[model samples]
Target: MITVVVFFSGSGIGTSTQMQHNNQASSSARERHPNSQIPLPQSNYAKHESGATRDSRRRKLKKQKVRPEKRKAGNLEYTNERNIAAHVSRGNKDRPIHKFKNSFVCYSNNARTKAVAVVKFYPFEGMDPERKAHYEQLSTNLIAHTRFQNAKKSNENTLGGTMYSLGWRKGFEEKSHLGITGIASKVAKDQEGWIKLFTETPWINDFLAQRFQDISLGMYREVKEQYDQQKAPSLTPFYMADPESFCGHLSFTFDNFYNKAHKDEDASPFRFAMWIPINKQTGKLVEENLQVEGGEFVFPEDGCAIDFSGFNGVVECVWKASEHPHHTLPSSTAIGSSDDRLGLSCLLPDSAERAIERMMAVEDGEKLDWTIQDLGHLHNDSLKYDSKGKPFETNDGVDLQASPPSACVLDEDSSTEPDKSLSSQLKVATPTQLHRST
Candidate 1:
């Protein structure tokens, strides 16, 4: 199948090598020699049970004829890296819907562009604790943001604009180059670092290569040539040698499971090129949120939807976005669901380089706003104002300096809240501007 996507499901193993090893072990154990009894892993639900007690429980379930999908994929317990396999699918699995861009012959399970297909990664066993914790905390932050704990209070009631965007450049206007102008990063460096999260992800990069290898090999080779000239001598193919020629962009949409159904106008030069970044653990969180609310991904054209509500498998999805006209279902979960429903868009180095060039060449590189335009390499749209009627800046906007502050998107790990006045806040809609939304 034309599955050029690797989702970080349950455990987020380091590489394919680890995946093969785990799968092989599972296969070997399943090769039961006609009579020998095999034991399932200890489940969290019965962690306190003695061996005999667990064995008795399994016997009971077996006698009851329990199916694999009704519970975990394996006999593993309810750990964070629980290998439930929680597999889900939709549409006709049989038959190819025509070869996608035909670099090689393959069919995409998610190939139904009009009706976007959502599938998750094959589950693996055991995950690193640190990584698991990282995902949990991120989810916590997302929920907190939604609850207003992380929100900077705002009183602006004017028309910001019609287009909404995420990610911003430091010391620059909020609405330039893939920007939602008034929304600045609480910490400057976070902008760049967020972009790297997807570009450097092992599976993400590998899958990107696998899915588009033939069509993109020539383009990758061209960059690899110049990457060879770097002085630091990093061995990775997608190394960040320089922002202009290297670097990437990661823009995202954060909301609950419910929203208006509209075509994702992301087919713009930089958007159709982006991909989703989700590892196993993060995928689990997304699925759980889906269960609470916002039950499915809907295709507006035919009003067809794949019910994703209630842990119905929210996992890694990859597509040639430009080729798809799609929209997603609003989340069902709301309270304490800051990190619940998320859609991320990423720009790898090749795309970023081209975007940066276009950004620099804007207005013959003369727009004073273009000084920090490189930030758009990741976010791609550096327009001071989206083509709509409103301006990006408000009379009371934060007073930024001519030169960007030394702190930037990459340095967000130790982010200290910038002055509350400069922090980004959800724009409060006034009675008059209620017609426009951010």
Candidate 2:
């Protein structure tokens, strides 16, 4: 019987054979060990590669392949500097959207001392036909003004400070060199005119200051009258609803240069007063009077007052109202000063009430009580006064003559009565006590 022997070797057998070979080799190597033994042969199939060595070899190869002509000097340095600057400047570019182009300079003393310098750059997008036509006319007019051209030559301080001119091809060259174009020319011209007007004209500055003062005063008077009419006892709680609006009076007063000491003892070089309106909803002062030209709105040791200068040369006044009296300490919570009385007055009683009602109803209304007071007082103070130091009164109770002595005092012990003619029929008492019983 020819029976073929069937033999099946499992995968484990192959592993066993490999293990046996490894063990035999290790044993032989151990047996051959000596004081100075030869190292075992390394397997060519078991090569060890290091990342550092591989990278070095790659770099060497790359360098060898690149031509010397292709290399640039300082290129790497420039790239590094550029990258660092870009990283540093990234935050600046992401600044708040409301950032002002001009720096605002605020002054507590004089409006003329305040200035704003704004820089604006313009480039051409698509031009409007009307704008282009306007520019063309403007350019023509500029050229027609020979005096302007002569002024440019004679006065080095004139428009010559700018780069563009209507002269030669060299003018165009300068334009191109500075990257200026038609649009840039137009912008420069407009800006130059504005700068000149702002910097060179005193009357212009005064006019602007006067206008701002007037507007501020008008707003303050209206607000004060509204508060008075409401007859609210105090304005100490409404600061949160609109802190900005409530503080508008303070800002206006400060800006107009109203001195607070004027209302203290009538000793200030300038006369002033302040009329603050309290918000009914929040019970905090809403707004103050704007400083007028002749009289000044001032805060007394107590309530507020607008002291006039000899009746009406220029009305200067400031008005401020807060939830708490600004000049007083927390421990001393009394209202009214030694000089001025506190209480709502008829002069502007309904002013505050009307304003509050309108504000609640979300309507816009305005009154000019402060202006009337300013002008009327000035007119009445101009009337003649009697020997008793009382201003001569008319049948209509309006003073038609200027006070005999402009330096007449309105103190308490003085039997001198205010010329009734000069006083407004409407008088609003403050909420606080009068500093002196008049």
Candidate 3:
């Protein structure tokens, strides 16, 4: 009978003894295989399985070790590159990416006509007390020296002539008190009163005499001498051209007006309908159908309307200028259309503040708190007028208003909501005198 023995040991004694026995058997088999093939021992098979298990463990360990190291190295490289790029971008200061943001257009409306006013609000950032005083003086002088009038010459005949010679040279002071000052006061004090006043006031005609005088002084000495010798010096020589002669013409016609009549409603400020005229023949707005550069007319886009919910006071109006047919259209047409009209660019406190901040961001690395109170610019020098029916030599200065406190940090606590009730009750008057003549 054959006898088989089985032994078990907790410390792997049995397994060790078996492995030793397998090694001896494998050596004997290899010696025999020198001349003949020999089957592998069972113990040798167990060793082979152990070797495979060890290899699999080594492979798992290698995969686990390499993956995280590669990830960490890649992360470190990315972070280092980002830091270097940011440092380089910050170090270069000569980049031309920043510019001033103090320009804006202000539009006022009345019963019969809408007037668009443009202003450039200069803040009190770097200005000392003396500079502030100087700016205030400039504003006062601009108001004091400003004037307006209806041209004496017919629109058809004065296409390229001086404003004074055209026959309209009325001073702003001589007209009714419902001018810019009056409207500004109403806006600052009583919202409802201002709304009513704006709808009822008549459009004034005026040109700045001081500005015309300045332009006259800037003329070449030779030109001045020739005019002096002829005794027929054109007082407003700059304005003797077609499109320049018709710059300040207010000819828009009104269509409708809405009176919300509530002080707390969001839509109460002012709303009006008007017709922007384009020459039916050429599909443009121009004097005598002459195609002039920068003389295109545009109306607001369809379905676009003013929203006054966030403003304390909102004023909206339409502006129309005759443009040459060959002129390229503006990229944005939100305010106007191809049929000879454009829409007014909308403004809010946040947007105006953004503009001011952007302007200040460009000047120097130094930060400034600039409050833009108002923005506007003077017309081209060609629109000046003199006492005698001739163009004025001086150029008019545009009025810019600014207050230190007007610009404040934009925070959640700022109260920018418009007077809802007052804005709602206000009505746009369509029977305005300015609309009839246009």
lDDT digits (tens) for residues 1-438 of candidate 3: 834455766544455566778898878888877877666535745667777798999999997888655544432332211111110111233443221132222222211122221112223344356534433332222222112322223323223212211111111342111111112321333333324432221211112222222222221222233322222201111111111111111122111112111221111111111112222223333112221223212122211122221121112222222110111122222133322221111111122223323432333334334322211001111123222324333345443333222332222223222233422443311211111000
Q: Which ten residues in a row have the lowest lDDT in candidate 3?
A: 429-438
Q: Which segments of candidate 2 are over 4 A away from where they belong? A: 1-94, 97-377, 381-418, 421-424, 427-438
Best by lDDT: 1
Candidate 2 residue lDDT tens string, 1-90: 644444457532335556568889877877777454655656543356677887899998887676332222111121211111111111
lDDT of every model, 2 decimals = 0.32, 0.26, 0.25
Judging by TM-score, tell me the better candidate of 2 and 3: 3
Judged by lDDT against the true structure, how good is candidate 1? 0.32
lDDT of 1 by residue, 1-438 (tens): 533446675765256666677787767877855466656666655677688987898898895675543333221221122232222222453522221111111112322112122223311124445444444443333322222113322213211111122222122334333221222332232433333332333333343333222223333343345433321111121212321221133333443323344433231222212212233224334422232444244344422343433332223343334444445544443455433445444333333344334443444224323333222221322223333412256568953223333321212122212222212221111111101011
Q: In each prediction, how many residue pairs overlap at the backbone (N, C-alpha, C within less than 3 A)?
A: 38, 75, 83
Model 1 off-target regions past 4 Å?
1-118, 121-131, 137-247, 257-291, 300-306, 312-314, 334-339, 347-355, 359-369, 373-438
Per-model RMSD to reference: 23.8, 29.8, 27.8
Report the lDDT of model 3 for residue 231. Answer: 21
The parts of candidate 3 lying over 4 Å away from their true place are: 1-275, 278-408, 415-438
